[model samples]
Target: MPAEFRAGERVRVRAGDPAGHTRAPRYVRGQVGRIVECQGSWELADEVAAGVAAPRVEPVYTVAFAAGDLWGEGGHEVTVDLWESYIERAERAERAGEDGS
Candidate 1:
């Protein structure tokens, strides 16, 4: 199956303070990042955490974030692997001079 997220696509991590076991890191929550790679599907963690017998599956992706975007300047860029469910489509501005519009 095709990956839910594609490389070069901008996506945002779901923001919330829910009480439960989750794979998404707290530091990345609500942060916008570009998908660097799609790691394919895997067993959903939410189902596992909920104790479901038949675990659901979802695509996982490696996302890249600029240091300045996540933290103040002088920080280095970082990347994290996240599940599809942990992120949502985020609108991104066109690259400069790409469209020539």
Candidate 2:
């Protein structure tokens, strides 16, 4: 399967504050990072999170985020595999009330 997200791309970790179930870690919320690799699509781990029983096709992307971009440099550099379901475009013009990008 071709990876949905490519390298050198900045993807946003999904922010689930009101609706939808996700497996993204809280530490990664609203953070920006560059893609390292695509781990293909897999079943969503939402079942392990809450009572949400929706299985989703989640593409995994290896990402590296600077501590300054996320929290601060005082924190160590963090790398994580984020799911596509938990990923979104930064400054999403569509989600930003513009065209549906």
Candidate 3:
């Protein structure tokens, strides 16, 4: 019921603006990550996403990105705290669909 998301899963930040100051950076958009931890659920904070006052609590996940995966060799491994709504399932399914051919 908490919008199922699990660790070791890859996700990318969704489009649209989120209210308040968040650690999820714009450069992180479309960046792939592996869920490291789940923070359960809490009232959707106005600062977390575009402030619309959505009463539903948004689950939070700690996503880890490889330095090389995100940036070039100069980039560091960044573990970002992302909301459940901000993520999309990885493209593995899409690739699988292509592989079926």
Candidate 4:
């Protein structure tokens, strides 16, 4: 499948406590971040770990989250490689309101 997000696009990590293993970091869940790069398609790690016979392949991306946004401290950003299913496009209107626009 084609990548759902491109570099420079904003996305919010899906927030949920899944029953099984997941690659999405706990701290980044529900946080908004920018897609820094598309890492190409790869087998879904969660499915692979679950022993699925045929894991689905999906787009992966490098996302950059502001440290302040994730922990309320620091000026640096943290980058994480996340699967497409782990994130959703962040709404533009919400972003505008966040920065007092």
Candidate 5:
């Protein structure tokens, strides 16, 4: 499937904390960040980790979060490679009161 988000767009990490393995970090959940790069399509790590039969491939992105936004105060930014399923459009998240911004 085509990428749902592109570089330079704002996205919010999904906040769900489902049981089992997940690559989405606890600190980043419900946070808004900007997509810095598209890392191309790859097998979904969460599914792979769960030993799914034929994991689905999806777009991965490098997302940058301001340190201040993430942890109250800091000068630098943190970047994380996140699968498409782990994020959604920031506007949508904001409308739903999920962006914590």
Candidate 6:
């Protein structure tokens, strides 16, 4: 199935450190970014690490974050491939006046 998020959509990395292996990094958790590309479906890393056969799949998205947004300043923009489970639509309050709401 196609991914929920399309290119250009804003998303925030889900926060939390689940027990065992995970691909989401701690630094990127709770950070907002724009989806740059859709990388289709991939097997879940956590399940694979646990040796689960027929593990569930998830869509992967390339998200871009501005350097200033992640840090104080001077850092260049960075893009990272994140699984759908790791991100969600950025909150309405986060978007604020952009939606004219």
| Residue lDDT tens for model 1, 1-101 | 45877898888899987678888988899988889998989988878998989887889999998878777764677999998989998743543333365
Worst 10 residues of 4 by lDDT: 90-99
Name the top TM-score candidate. 4
What candidate 6 gets wrong by more than 4 Å, as runs, is 97-101
lDDT of 2 by residue, 8-100 (tens): 777777666635555567888877667888878776676546655765566778888777757756566678987776777666563345334
Winning candidate number (lDDT): 4
What is the lDDT for 92 in model 6?
83
lDDT of 6 at 7: 91
Ranking by TM-score: 4, 6, 5, 1, 3, 2
- Candidates ranked, most accurate by lDDT first: 4, 5, 6, 1, 3, 2
Q: For all the candidates, what are their Cα RMSDs to the real structure?
A: 3.2, 5.9, 4.1, 0.9, 3.6, 1.9
User: Where in model 1 is the C-alpha error above 4 Å?
Assistant: 92-101
Angstrom error of the Cα, residue 52, model 4: value is 0.4
**What TM-score should be assigned to candidate 1?**
0.81
Give each model a TM-score.
Answer: 0.81, 0.68, 0.69, 0.95, 0.88, 0.89
Question: Candidate 4 at residue 24, lDDT?
Answer: 97
Q: Which tens-of-lDDT digit does each residue in 8-86 have in candidate 4?
A: 9899999998989999999999999999999999999999999999999999999999999999999999999999999
Runs in model 4 deviating more than 4 A are none
Local accuracy of candidate 3 as per-residue lDDT tens digits, 1-101? 37578887777677666556555578677777778989777665545356655555788888888778666765667888777877888788754664494
User: On residues 3-95, what C-alpha lDDT tens digit does candidate 5 reach at each position?
Assistant: 988888888899999788888999999999999999999999889999999999999999999999999999999999999999998886564
How many angstroms is residue 36 displaced in model 4 relative to the true structure, after the best TM-score fit? 0.1
Which is better, 3 or 4, measured by TM-score? Answer: 4
Residue 66 error, candidate 3, Å: 0.8
